[model samples]
Target: MSALDPSVAGQLAEDLPPDVFRTIIATFEEDLTRLVQELQTAHESGDQNGYERAAHSLAGASAAVGAVGLEREARIAMDHRQPEAAATVLPRLVAEAKGALEALHALIH
Candidate 1:
């Protein structure tokens, strides 16, 4: 498994201007934060469909930015279609995503 960080610069720097790459990273961060919120809300409300949506979104977004840990956790959560299973995975997914976000912030700054 790859280590997680905001590695967008390495992936996109060759093709994009530094400013634009930074913008992409910033956008990713914003979107991820929002998705995490959605996951939290869905988990709290026992909304299986909402949880799955948020988890799937998180998995895709994190994968795009090379957030391996977050992506892995999110994928696991996403695979849990049942409410009980999703609820069981939510804490770990949230924890891993938060850790990945911290790593991303450190890299961005």
Candidate 2:
């Protein structure tokens, strides 16, 4: 996990167990929370790149976990150069990410 890119989900999942994935989901959930917080900061600071990076990460992770809703939200987020434009999409991403995590947990355990 150390040598490989943490951004790729397949490699991220290679060593982690189902329970660990759930734990990972928990961590991601926190990350998402922090992401939104950072979005607020970025928007206030007019940091377009910050917003984009976070959205891009969200898109990749959502796609990896089969979270179509989150992926959609993330795409919407990444599409806009302005965080205000992507603001509404964040909740959907959170919901979808949660759903995808739940589904994976069910299938795994």
Give the Cα-based TM-score of candidate 2 against the true structure: 0.61
Best by lDDT: 1
lDDT of 2 by residue, 1-109 (tens): 0211234444556667877877876776676677767766776688888977777877776666555666777777777654555556666656666666555445444
Q: Would you list the clashing residue pairs of candidate 2?
A: none
Clashes of each: 0, 0
* Clashing residue pairs for model 1: none
RMSD of 1: 3.1
The parts of candidate 1 lying over 4 Å away from their true place are 5-9, 81-88, 105-109
Go through the candidates in order and give the C-alpha RMSD of each one to the true structure.
Answer: 3.1, 6.9
lDDT of 1: 0.73
Question: For candidate 1, lDDT tens digit of each residue in 13-100?
Answer: 4566667767877888788789988988988898878988988998888888778888878887787644546556767777776776
Q: Report every candidate's CA lDDT.
A: 0.73, 0.64
TM-score of 1: 0.75
